[model samples]
Target: MIKIEDITFVAAEAYKRSGLVLSTDKGYLLESRLAPLARAEGYPSIEALIAAARRESNDRLLWAITEALATHETFFFRDNTPFDLFKQEILPVLSRARGNMSTIRIWCAACSSGQEPYSLAMILEEEKARLGGLRFEIVATDMAPRVLEKAKAGVYSQFEVQRGLAIQRLVTHFDQSGDQWRIKPNLRSMVTFQKQNLLENFSGMGTFDVIFCRNVLIYFDADTKKRILQRLAAQTASDGYLIMGAAETVVGLSQDFAPVEGRRGLYGRSGAAKSAAA
Candidate 1:
């Protein structure tokens, strides 16, 4: 058995480095996640793996550990309600507001495995005629480079596809390649995947009309969440929407954003007109 104290210390440091938080109870979870990698590396126990990681010159091992611990569990349209609201209410309004602008920008902050942004692309493609020739640019970012590689590939297993993706869209937008479904090139082209750490400054990415940062902040501590939210707010256009997970809220975190009532998972800058009201 590995010393829980040593494991906790290392885990705490690693989480701090990655801007993720892990409770003491999560030590076992981390042990379980890294067991395979440890075995592959010929390390007898978690302690050996930790020591090796601490001294390893490659740096890839540390990244592998972080990537393994980082959550990449996502699917196309994982939550249906938010995407529906985006299609029915948000996009039209944003499109009208942009008017003659050639492009509309969107960002998927914690875009795990690419589903969320790809789903947005599918919706935009479906509504292209109504968009009146406006180009849509979707920036999908995640901290894990491995997951970003998978996302860039735009290929998903049948089980992954069935998870929130409808049959009609699947049939229309994807190609059957053996056991996996490949998202069509056109839809995939709409999004550009990038490796990003949300905890750091995002000023280089420029402004976005909407940012979907769902379900990823639950892992951060309060202060980390506040800093991340502030950076997210700064990256957003004044009237842009900031969509968070349904279970998450920014009520006391910052005064820059206001909640959108009746529309769960939707938030907008305080001074902006409510999508529901508009």
Candidate 2:
């Protein structure tokens, strides 16, 4: 039997050690996630899993416990409005700014299971001819190696493709692999996926024209959010854009980023906005 209070305490501790701010109101949520993990790992009971969490030698088990709390919903072209803004407003400005050099480099942080990056590849492919000589490259990173490997393989199940993916796009871009759909080689080639932890240093990552860190900040605390925004600012080009989730914001978190005029959920470095104003 799982001791509710004991499992709850361990779950919260694991999340903290994982660098995520676990919500206190999620008692039932933790139980639901932990129950499956306990059963699959051959733990005699959820209590056994909680006890294993206390043991320092079981690093893999501890990590598994922490990772369970990171569950979130993801889909291709998740929120339509942001992608629309990217296509209509952002891309053209960046393309024009590049002038003689025709390249657009974009980074997608916290990309899970490859849907988001694959969506980006599709949009860029559509815009390729219009941009003249511009070549679009995407660097997508997620903290989970398991998911990163899956993303790199460019394969998705029927249910995953059904969400936010239109029939026309499905027919054009994916080849049937048994019951699963695999992204075409050409489209898959456009994105490079790797494992990256947001809390760590990313100085070696060159500045990008646009950075998509959407729907990820809500899981972090105030200080972590601010620190991440600052890191992202350092890696974003002066004229580049940063897009977050619809519900997320930069207000009071970091002064370096300000919302773009007439655009919601889009931000640019304050210094860049000031330069544009001048």
**Pick by TM-score: which candidate is best?**
1
Using alpha carbons, what is the TM-score of model 2?
Answer: 0.92
Backbone clash numbers for all candidates listed: 0, 0
> For model 2, how does the per-residue alpha-carbon lDDT over 1-278 read when each residue is reduced to its tens digit?
44567656765666555457755566676678888989989987777887876765477877677766675468999998778877887877887788745778899998988888899889888777787877777999887776788899988999999999999999899999789999999999999887788877787888898999999998888888988999999999888899999899999999989988767789998867522221
Whole-model lDDT, model 1: 0.85
lDDT of 2: 0.82
List the global CA lDDT of all models. Answer: 0.85, 0.82
Over the stretch 82-112, how does candidate 1's per-residue lDDT look in tens digits? Answer: 8988899888788778885568899998898
Per-candidate TM-scores read 0.94, 0.92
CA displacement after TM-score superposition, residue 225 of candidate 1 (Å): 0.7
